[model samples]
Target: MNARHDHSHQREFNLEDREFRFLVSFLSRETGIVLSEHKRQMVCGRLVKRLRSLGMRDFAAYCALLDSPAAGAEVEHLVNAITTNITNFFREPHHFDHLRHQVLEPRLSQSPKKPRIRIWSAGCSSGQEPYSIAMVMAEVLKPSEAWDALILATDIDTNMLKRGADGIYSAEDAAHIPENYRKRFVRRLHNDSDHVQMADELRRLIRFKRLNLHEKWPMKGKFDAIFCRNVAIYFDKPTQRALFNRYADMLHVGGMLYLGHAESLIGMNDRFEASDKTVYRRIR
Candidate 1:
């Protein structure tokens, strides 16, 4: 019994060097994400369940399947498994504050004739960032009937997209929302006190979709502001450079680009000038 348990454990957890290299290459090619040597164990842990579900005895079999024609259906599952989705409601408070003060507030005086406003929450994991943006939009663009505003929330992970579309979160998750906004935009489900749903008004202002940044973007119109925070940390410099260039092309002149706290474009791109800490403006 002990020997059998040991063999099963080894088969489940062991990630061979050759298999790891193949996965790294495949992930980079498909998703533009570079998995380093240090991530080997994490890859092993994340994919073990996949192997079990497919009756795969080892990483070698999984890699073979991915390399085969049968990989089409498995590709999405692989992407969903390995992609990290760490986010929370109002994770970075300052970005929302900036959006309210610099991006949305100024629009109040410029055009009451239904001025268009578009904000993209790229790599919007589990929907918190976009919902937070919606809250601020509701607060700043008062009488909400007058503004042509929309938040495009997108992520490569379909599971996360579903969660974002559902707009339901735990009380703990909703705690980050300010009390005033909570009172107005959070709905408590009867017989459930631990979880709450985002109000319809906020949901009405957002659209969630699956978007892989490595591939072509289908969005045709230019955006006024983009919140792509904390997502670039996964890509290599070349990928990051290309992605930022695309972002610059997608934004209008003087439009805002909000990045993660740890990310910056100092030597990466010249099209943007820093507007605040980790925040940039497309300057042509």
Candidate 2:
């Protein structure tokens, strides 16, 4: 092990105003993440671990290192440290409810033989969101071989993408998945039943990739539905507006767009119409 591991975790640094402003600007410009004055302590708390890991004693030293040419490669690590990864199976259950009843069911029954079903989980932190979509689809698209159901799970954090690809979760998380679906889509770990793996069928349905929503997206086709829930909450209004417009462009006309309960498209864009609480349908 490293000698740094022996150091006490109580190290503290008084972050300076100039450093904070530079950090805020840098993060916003590079990642489109708006860091406000109120988030100073939160930013400090998150980056403190990074500084300690790199043997940085003060925020000024950290800032100097970050501004240096050698720091070009560290931004992803910085983002991994700062990006929030809180997610779970079937989070915001109503979204799943809407997805099942309003989205998938109707598609399954479409008369002209709809063989393709595409869903995008825009901020699929740790895989749960996309897995949830897969679980629902697995049940709805009976004899799953009949449909080309695919889920694109994307996040800016590479670490989160790895975890999502691994498809492991604390066993406690199983409770959030509906009982009927859980048995088919979840498997207890061999040595530890207290943890679980998403079943192969579920994993097979999702394609996890790293995507920074603010940057140019390389995806080609329009999706039938896009679940960007809770992701826009951190972006400024203009960013949110631009993102939603881009989502609008990427979604099929009449496709569904699900937002976090705390987020809304009100006064932001006109391409979508409210179809359900906190849900919008692409209309234009």
Candidate 3:
């Protein structure tokens, strides 16, 4: 259960129609995260803590704060509160399998000109996906010194980016990662066995930054692969289409794009052909 989890049990607040509409419009305009009428309860539930934290009594006061002169600093917290960061290490294993067997392995046979490898973890939450990817990269390209490899991990939530950069995770989080990668990329804390840290070698391969997908990306060169899984499911079809096209533009001609199991590019974008279930390869 993702954002749909019932939150009606929380202390209820009077969320007026005007405030809700303003919220929906503001979120959609600023971050491309659409909040439908049906999601009002979920939105309220997610943001109730913010209201409490700001010492506001109700949604009206919260909405007022968003429109006030002090709104500049709160916008970051607003996005952090509203967005759902549902992710796990190797949440979708098949994609990484493909990245290993199909993507990285092929490059191993390339000409002596040491190939450059770039992978993007769009909406990477708390760093697991990119770190998992880093493990795969370093494994496939060990003596990785020969090749230039980098993983750019970006998310709209600055908090998530900071956590990802920190590379610390609950011990339970390490359970989801496959054994081979687990041993190689992560190590348990000597003092606190409850947490694990991504190894320095793997950490060096990633760069985490706060980014709004709706805004123009600052990256110059194309990536060899992009993992935007489960990100666009919250966006409207038109937004998803536009985002996918932008991803296509940012990828080399034959670069791979991995989506969530529930997401696909069918009827949305034509520049890609399905190379595998929930995976697309740029063709045009």
Candidate 4:
């Protein structure tokens, strides 16, 4: 029975084998997102909708369309649709906790001059991560005079960056935000369902930009902290190693690197020493 079931599954997937390989190769080459063999069905399932939406009957036709010059814009949409961007405000609470209690507090206390903190949220999807950082900063530094802190939120998807720049969120997205933050930094809308808009002050602190991590980064100056959580998982080992090195160069000595719970720098680079799971400090 098990053998027969396995055979049936293989037969079902055989139809898409070639198209699946093409999509995996195309996406990997273009976006640096590698689709593993286990994700074959997921690729088909996610992109088949796009194929249908584009009026293409089959995956082969969709691949052909992707190869066309006219489809350049469409390719971005396709990648954005298929890529997962699941995140929420304060999703990883401990990281923020550490930043506030461990890093920011000590820097402020030790520095005689007014301290300016810069943080980059490398895969800041829809503004949650960066906004969360801003909210924490607001708590630590008084809003009236402490305006030098900046959070640069960036992502590869322009669609996501636009949403982040708008700073609007549905009620569900605001659930994880603390009540005090929700009241102070977010304005509730009466007519627009249960949505909330980020207050101007908080919004002003975050600068959103579309940044492709695989390409050369245009920003100058080292950041005090960099939150690149969950962004490097799609990249291959070499890319991951190079990215870690670049991040080290972009961070000030003793600056911290926060990664996703599932990610680590083990054997990747020597510039950073592991401070904890998903956390590293620039040592060199």
All candidates: CA RMSD in angstroms?
1.0, 3.5, 4.7, 4.5
Worst 10 residues of 4 by lDDT: 8-17
Error of 2 at 251 (Å): 0.3
Q: Top model by lDDT, which number?
A: 1
Task: Give the per-residue lDDT of model 2 (tens digit) for 1-284.
Answer: 35565443344466779989989988888889998899998899899888889998888888888898989768888889888998888888888888889888888778336489899999888988999999989998877888888999999899999989999988888789888998888888898978899999988899999888989999999999999988998899889989999999999999999999899998999999999999999999
**Alpha-carbon runs more than 4 Å astray in model 1:** none
Roughly what TM-score does model 3 have, to 2 decimal places?
0.93
Query: TM-score of every model?
Result: 0.98, 0.93, 0.93, 0.89
The TM-score, computed over Cα atoms with residue i paired to residue i, of candidate 4 is 0.89
Estimate, for each residue in 18-127, the C-alpha lDDT of model 1 and write its tens digit: 99999999999999999999999999999999999999889999999999998887999999999999999888788888898888988888887889999999999899
Best by TM-score: 1
**Per-residue lDDT of model 4, residues 106-182, tens digit only:** 87787646678889999898889999998888888774264468899998888898999999999889989988888
**Model 3: residues >4 Å from true position, as ranges?**
1-12
lDDT: worst 10-residue window of model 1 = 7-16
In angstroms, the error of model 1 at 223 is: 0.5
Stretches of candidate 4 off by over 4 Å are: 1-15
Where does model 2 exceed 4 Å of error?
Answer: 1-12, 111-114
Local distance difference test values of all predictions, in order: 0.94, 0.89, 0.89, 0.84
